[model samples]
Target: MRIAILDVDYRSNVARAACVTAPSWATELPLATHVSDIESVQEYEPGAFYKRELPCLLRVLEQLAAKPDVIVIDGYVWLDGACRPGLGAHLYQALGNATPVVGVAKTAFHGAETCPAVVQVRRGTSARPLFVTAVGVDLAEAAGWVRGMAGLHRIPSLLAAVDQLSRSTFETPPGASAANAVAG
Candidate 1:
């Protein structure tokens, strides 16, 4: 199975989106990595974080040659017990809800602990557990996938690589395409 893990980082006028593709849940390395730079990104809103992030993620996904079977994001699919849509939820909608999205958040969102669909996964001797939420997949199955991911730390290796990719700097030439592809 192909899994695409996504993340985004921002500057004053730019948003850098990174996609790390792994062959399976337990894969330690990515099969390919892609980055896209979206220009003139919206300023972050206090309670509407998805407003700034969703577009950047969508733009980067366009760089992929084919749609991934599943997508793992660095945030929540559902925000709270009330089921407010988060970034992954919005992305799921954008993709017509065909692909399952698993969200692995580094920290717990307030009130998420009360959500039955939200599961906490602890990995590798870490005291702090990762908060997991999902859409289009079973909550337990999603949590199990996360727990099985290859990593010796709290964060899975591919997740950490995507995080680092987002923060890494790169130059885009004038009038180039939004995406920059680098296969691994």
Candidate 2:
């Protein structure tokens, strides 16, 4: 099965999508293609941090034109907006059952329990912990894969590469400073 691991870039309109492969028996999440796009995610209220993320979500979903059987999304769907169940659920509705969708988040939900297959853990350089709430794809599969292919480094391999790629896409540094870009 062809799998794409997705992650969002806070600095730009692009989201990262890469092919996930197991290079060794124990490791998975080897990423490639690592494309980025400008999408519309304004569905969330302006005050919401993810309001601007709508564009990336749309652009990321459009990549599904290739019709990979499974799409592993970057954030766990929760709250009212952005890419959580609202967007993920909406997207799944648009794609129908023909395509299976899964959400993974760095932050967990306090008000709700969880669906089957989602996992939680800390990611990124700061290692600042957040709950990962995913709905579309099976995280049991993703975590086992993530255990190997990446470092505790600030950015996930796929997301890090995608962040770099999106900056290059516009020929810009992503922000006033590279540091700002990554931090954003």
Candidate 3:
């Protein structure tokens, strides 16, 4: 399956979104990579973090040549068992709920342990667990895919690549078209 791992980073007024695609969960290297820069991103809100992030993610996703079978994000899908929508959930809705989203958060949300939507996964002997949440896929299956991802550390390789890509310096100048900024 073609799985896309996505991440975003902000610098000054610009937000950079990066996507890394792999054929399988255990692949160490990406089959392709894409980056898009969004200017004047919205300010981060306390409980509405998705407002600042979802647009950037959607813009970057547009750069993909084909829709991914599944998407992995760097945050929660549901904030709690009540199914309070987070970034991933908002993304699922925005896509018409056609794509499955798996959220692998580095830190736990408050009361995440008891949340039915959340699954805590320990990897690579690290005491700190990855807080996993999902929509449109089995939580246990998502956790297994994450646990099987190619990496020696707690964070999977593709996730690390996307993170680094989002934060990396873009060669295209500010105000340049997204076409100039995207790289595969």
TM accuracy, model 1: 0.95
Worst 10 residues of 2 by lDDT: 175-184
Please report the TM-score between candidate 2 and the true structure. 0.53
lDDT of each: 0.90, 0.45, 0.90
Segments of candidate 2 deviating more than 4 angstroms: 7-55, 60-65, 79-84, 108-118, 122-130, 136-139, 152-155, 167-184
lDDT of 2 by residue, 132-151 (tens): 44444564655544433365
Per-residue lDDT over 1-184 for candidate 1, one digit per residue giving the tens place of the 0 to 100 score: 8899999988777878999998899999999999998777888898899999999899889988889999999999999887889988999999999999999999888776678768999999999999999999998999999999999999999999999999888567433436789998
List all candidate RMSDs to the true structure: 1.6, 7.4, 1.5
lDDT of 1 at 169: 83
The clash count for each model shown is 0, 20, 0
